[model samples]
Target: MEFLFQILVILLAARLLSEVSERVGMPGILGEILAGLLLGLLIVEETETIASVAELGAIFLLFTAGYKEVHIEDLKASSKKAIVATFFQIAAAFIAGFALGRFFGFDFVESLFLAVAFSPTSIGVVVKTLLDMGYLSSKPGSMMLTSAIFDDIIGIFLLSIVVTVGKYNAFPTATQFMLLLGKLVFFVGIMVILGYRVFPYIFNYVQKMHSKESIFAAVVLIALFSAYFAEIMELDAVIGAFIGGVMLSNVAVAKINDIQSKVSGLAYGILVPIFFAHIGMAVELEALNTLGSFTILVVVLALLGKLIGGFVGARAIGFDSYESFIFGSGVMPRAGVELVVISIGREMGIIGEEIFSAVVLMVVVSIIISPIILKFAIQKDKQKNTSVPAS
Candidate 1:
């Protein structure tokens, strides 16, 4: 009964607030997050069940993101720009965090963890924002999605290095680092093989089944399986889910469209809301009381780092100024991956509570602010394009 009540309240609040947000020219997620934060003040404790459901929300969000909005060819086409963008974005964010840490008298290991925390762009946030603004199929959107994927991969590698240093007080050896790299390569290689060569036949057979909804069930199963496989390889599960979605995108079955619609409905209408709200509920609002100049600097630098990195990378690849700004805004929001890194660091005693709180604040600010900036940039670009005569 208690669990049921919590779900009921969360859903109603999220939907109500989301409607309000959308009517006001902002993304609905902003309201859903606010709903969670309000409930957080009253609920006091989050149940494990809620957390698990939220995790599924994220998985399904990424899975549908890949299945519906992004095609394999889009990913391939954007690969070069995505790589360049990700390289600059990660490098800038990492440097900013490290420099801040050193300036504040932290040692090498602490500084390294700070750098790792600053480097990742949240796939869920970026994808949700792009979907909200109807830009997921655009060139900037494709690049953002691909760049976020690479960011997660690099984040995993950096986290591994940070953990090693924190636990053993030394950096990972050359062989150890190589083994880690091998795991990443193997995961991507297997995913490509399975997605291109194997899953097509499997899904084709499933769709032809007489069983009710067999294709849908198979897709869900494959998504879950892929996510689990990625986890065992020390990679993020969202990556696996995304790859699974991308792989199934080329299935030529008649019901593919229906399946994608169902998947999208389930993800966005139910699960994804819970995911965003859960992130909001996790915020310790009291952290605001502890904010200082250093915390303010951390937030500023974190946002600026990604913005500059994305803009520079996009411009280098010949994107116009407006397109570059859109890309920069798209990469600014940090959530799940950043939170995980800081939480692990806190637990391992590699960073103090002060640093952890500052990063959390940064995440909150980014998720709240980035959507508004990105939405405005997108709208402005649309207006500009429409004003010009077609070439």
Candidate 2:
């Protein structure tokens, strides 16, 4: 009962803060994170539960992103460019992060883990920015989405690798590393192949039932259950849920969209806000204060890494100067999804208190700038044309 009450307070506070931020022309996520921090300071002990619940929000956020953003044709058309740009971003970010961490006196595993965090672009932030800028239908929007999808895949893999390395001091032997890699690959491959084949059949059969409630129940069951199974496979549940959503891409967009809309209402209206509030609860004032300077430096470097990486990577893949900036800016935000990775690192014991505090603060800063960064870059190219959506 106490927990439930805390959740209610958190949700109401977050909603109110979000509204106030919007009224002031600031991004809502910034307000949300700051609210979490203030609450965390006021009620420090609740931060743990907040972290855990927000973790679920992270999963649902990913699933929501995957469900909403992917379009097969755009992906297919831009496959080559997407692949090139994504790899470049991954490599550049990883190396830069690795170097920075080592220079900052982190050990091999710590450096590697931080590097892995740096390497992946935050997909949810990117998509939101794209939608806000009205660029979801434009060429740059398509590229951003494609690169982000690949970024999620690549980032997850890098994180898993870093976790494995952290577990073994000198790095696992080649054979052992490969074996773990194989297990991960097999797990993801089987889920994707089998899931794509099964979900459509299940949805079709459920459709025949002709009951809205039944259909919704079935969808919920599928999404959550798939997420559970993914967790069991030593992968992120959100990844599973996200994949579950994408597999349904072949479904009737209108119907699946309708289902997602409903699912999202429950998710966003109740579950998701609860999750975000939990993120607020988890912020550590003392640790963040201690690491304030370092945290700011990290936020700046991470932002630059994403920006430069997105730009150089996009240009390398044949995008023009303006488009490259779009690619860079599209990936500037770091919020829900990145926090999920940090939570996972915490769970695995790879992220200590200092790192966690820095990440939470970094998230706050990055999210604050995400919209502005995306808008500036976009308008740089289209000042005379229709404005891009900068959601």
Candidate 3:
């Protein structure tokens, strides 16, 4: 009964706050996060069940994001811009964050962890904003999604290197690094090949079943299986879930579309909101306040690093100033991957509580700010295009 009550309160608060946020023209996630923050301040204890649900929320969120927003063929075709932008974005952010950490007196490993924390854009936030604005299928949206996917892959790889070096107190040997990379490539390559060739036939057979929920059950199973596979391979489970969704997308678009509402209903109605709120609830407010200036600096660096990296890359690839700004702003938010990196760093003792709190603050602030900036840039670009006569 106690657990039930807590769940009820959380769900109600999240839904109410999300509605308010949407009514104000902001993303509902902002309110959901704030709801979590409020609950954290008020509730004395958080249950393990809640935590477990939040974890599932994150997984389902990523899976839904991949299913809806990303297409592998499209990603491959437009790989050029995404690759260039992601490389520059990660490099710029990592350097800036490392420099900031060093300025604050953190040692080499700690500074590198800080750099990794700032490097990945949270595609969940970016995708939600794009979807809200009806731009998910647009060119800028495609670039943002693809860039974010690369951002996660590279950021996670860098994180593994940082963690290994921190644990051993020495840089990994060249051969060691190559082996890690090789394993990652092999995992992705095999998943892609099998997902493309085998999974479609499996799903095709499943689709012939008369049970209304059979396809949905198959999707959930595949997502969970891929997620487990990735974790066992020492990669992030969210990455596996995303890849699974992408593969399923290629095979069963029409069938999946048929059940999209049912899947989305389950995710958004419960799990995804919990994930966002949990982020807010996890903040250590007192620690954040004590490290206020440092927190502000981190947030500034995080925002500028991604923005400038993305903007410059987009411009280099011939995007107009407005489009470039939109792309840059779209990729500026740091949430899911950043939080995971910081958690790993904390567990490894590479970062202390103060830095953890500050980065959490950075995540919340960035989550709030990035969507607003992206919305403004997108609107401005639309107005500019509207004002121009068709060539």
Candidate 4:
């Protein structure tokens, strides 16, 4: 009964706040997060069941992102820019984070974990904002999505390395690094074969079934199975869920759209909101109060690192100044993966509450700021284009 009431209150609060946020020209997610913060102030307990549901929310959120936003073929065809930009973005952010940690007197391992936390762009937040602004299919959006895919894969791999080293208090040997790379390659190769050569045929038959939800069921099963497979292999489950969605994206466009709508309804309406709220609830407000300087430093570095890296990479790939700035703005927000990285670091005792709280604050601030900047960039671009003389 208590659990039921908790869900009810969270849902009601999230919906109301989200509606209010949208009306005020802010992202609905910001409101959902605020709802969580409000509830946290009012209620002290966070149950295990709530945590489990939140995890599901994250999974479904990524799964739907892959299904709706990513286009593998498009990513492959124009991946050069994304790859280069992702490299620079990760490099810049990682180095900046490490420097900040060292300045604060953290040990090498802790500094490295902080670096890893800042390296990946959070696709969930970026995708939501782009979709909201009707830019998900624009050139800048494609670049952001493709770059984010690489960011996630590389980030997770780096995280595995960091966690292993932190656990043993020793750097990984060459052989250990090779083994990790081998595992990653093997997973991708198998997913490619199964997704292309096997799953389509199976899904084709499933689509013909008379049951109303067969396609949806099959897609969910595949997503869950892929997530389980990745977790068992010591990689992030969201990675698998995302790849699974990408794999099935081209199989049955019409039926997939239907399934996507239903999944989106389930995710956004309930699961995803809970995920955002959980992030809010988990924040240690007291830690933030004590870590004010550190929080400010992190927020600045996290924003500028990704922004500069993205801008430079986009320019190198031939985007004009305005477009490059938009790309930079698009990748500035960090949330889902950043949270996961820091949470794991904290659990391993490699990061204290202060650093964790500071990063959470950074994520929230980035989330709020990135979309507003991106929207501004988009409108500016539109005005510039409109004023240009016809060729």
Please name the candidate that would achieve the greatest TM-score relative to the true structure: 2
Question: What would the TM-scores of all predictions be?
Answer: 0.75, 0.83, 0.81, 0.83
- For residue 170, model 1's alpha carbon misses the true position, in angstroms, by 6.8
Better of 2 and 4 by TM-score: 2
Q: Which residue pairs overlap in candidate 3's backbone?
A: none
- Candidate order by lDDT, decreasing, is 4, 3, 1, 2
Residue-level lDDT of model 1, residues 220-313, one tens digit each, is 8888998899778766666667766766677665236787778778888888888778766766655655657778988999999998888888
A best-first ranking of the candidates according to their TM-score comes to 2, 4, 3, 1
Which stretch of 10 consecutive residues in model 4 shows the poorest summed lDDT?
249-258
- Badly placed stretches (over 4 Å) of model 3 are 79-82, 107-110, 122-171, 210-212, 253-255, 318-327, 340-352, 371-391
Q: Which has the better TM-score: candidate 1, or candidate 2? A: 2
**TM-score of predicted structure 3:** 0.81
Give lDDT for model 1.
0.78
What do the candidate models score in CA lDDT, each in turn?
Answer: 0.78, 0.71, 0.78, 0.79
Give the range where candidate 1 is weakest over 10 consecutive residues by summed lDDT: 69-78
lDDT minimum window of 10 residues, candidate 2:
248-257
- The residue-by-residue lDDT of candidate 4 on 1-391, one tens digit each, is 9999999988888889989988876667778878888898898367788888887777777677667766766656756667887887788888999999999998888888889888888765667667887888888788887887677667666776787667656666888767766776787788888888888888878878999888778888887887788777666666677777777777773245667788788889999899778766777788888878888999999889888888888888888888888898988888767776776676567888777778877887898898888889888887788889754
Give the Cα error of residue 17 in candidate 4, in Å: 1.7
Better TM-score candidate (1, 4): 4
